[model samples]
Target: MPKQAMENLTESMFYVLMALQRGDACGAEITAYAAQVSGGAVRLGPATLYTLLARFEKEGFLTDAGTVGCKRYYRLTAAGKAAYEGERARLQRCLDDAARAEITAPASLTKGDARDETARQGNRLPSGSLPVL
Candidate 1:
């Protein structure tokens, strides 16, 4: 099936919406929020940030909240909140699903036998991350 925009919010997309939960924010503020929330896991640089902001604004998930100089501000719409909350719920379910199962990492993965075990599989989960079966 052909994909639809925002069908599944990317980590960056989710963070953009989340960053506006408190109030309005500029591009820089949103990027900082994403980095803070993801423990530096998700970084949205200018190009990526503006691209997402444009897409979100186009999708009705966000609205322009005026601008200061060259910095444009945005506010999360009701739709945006719904999208963010939906992603949150979906992630919670993932954790719940993982919790109900057992994870066993093979020696190869545990010993970092490969170039980057963590990158290859979630078996040997990195710090602050979930494991793969």
Candidate 2:
């Protein structure tokens, strides 16, 4: 059976592709880079990272660059770079549209948004505290 082309990437997939932009990296290095770049917001566990690596390689977006010891490295192909850039642009457009809508939106729409949440209180939560609605 033929594999279908990916039309879009999920958040983790997008970050993994973005991580490769720094240079060729092995699985551990890519996971570290993604975490560092995302300020710990994205954590790629071993299983998830390996799955993505295998899938991207199959999709022609990545290639085996080298292997050192047990760790295999991956490099982005031209198609991978294009995929990253395309996803970035798509994300940017989504943000742009949201910004435009926010500006034109009626006041009620943004009342539950982050800005309001912040203003509701210099009311910051403590470490590990769940936010109060």
Candidate 3:
């Protein structure tokens, strides 16, 4: 099967989209905002930032808002918002799975405990229904 576009965004792509969420910004401004938001963990080089801007524009995730002097500004399009939301939900699911695993570690689970836990989560089977072995 063909790989999906934007199914998995790189850290740089995520931060870049996040930065644009604030408002339209030039390349330098976007890079600075990314660094600030990530607590200096994500610093986009000029080349990387430019390349991302170009790709995003081509993919309809961003639009060239305008230009001032030599600086070009960009704004997020609806496609960009969708991509950002999709990434956010994907990350949240990862966190939820990790937390669920931590709470249900094999070492802490016993035979009957699984049934009790399922009941607590409102997933109780019909009365007298056999649990899958």
Against the true structure, whose TM-score is highest? 3
Provide the RMSD of all predictions against the true structure, rounded to 1 decimal: 9.2, 8.6, 9.7
**Model 3 weakest lDDT span, ten residues long:** 107-116
Error of 3 at 5 (Å): 2.4
lDDT of 2 by residue, 1-133 (tens): 6545666788889989988998899988889988998999999999999999899999999999999999899999999999999989989999999999988997655568765777588866676976543
Please state the error at residue 77 of candidate 3 in Å.
0.3
Q: What is the TM-score (0 to 1) of candidate 1?
A: 0.72
Candidate 3 has which clashing residue pairs, if any? none
RMSD in Å for candidate 1, one decimal?
9.2
- Residue 26 error for model 2, in Å? 0.4
For model 3, how does the per-residue alpha-carbon lDDT over 41-83 read when each residue is reduced to its tens digit? 9999999988988999999999999999999999999999999
lDDT of each: 0.84, 0.88, 0.90
Clashing pairs in 2: none
What lDDT score goes with residue 42 in model 1?
Answer: 92
Question: Could you tally the backbone clashes for each prediction?
Answer: 0, 0, 0
Q: Between prediction 1 and prediction 2, which has the larger TM-score?
A: 2
Ranking by lDDT: 3, 2, 1
Off by over 4 Å in 1: 1-3, 103-133
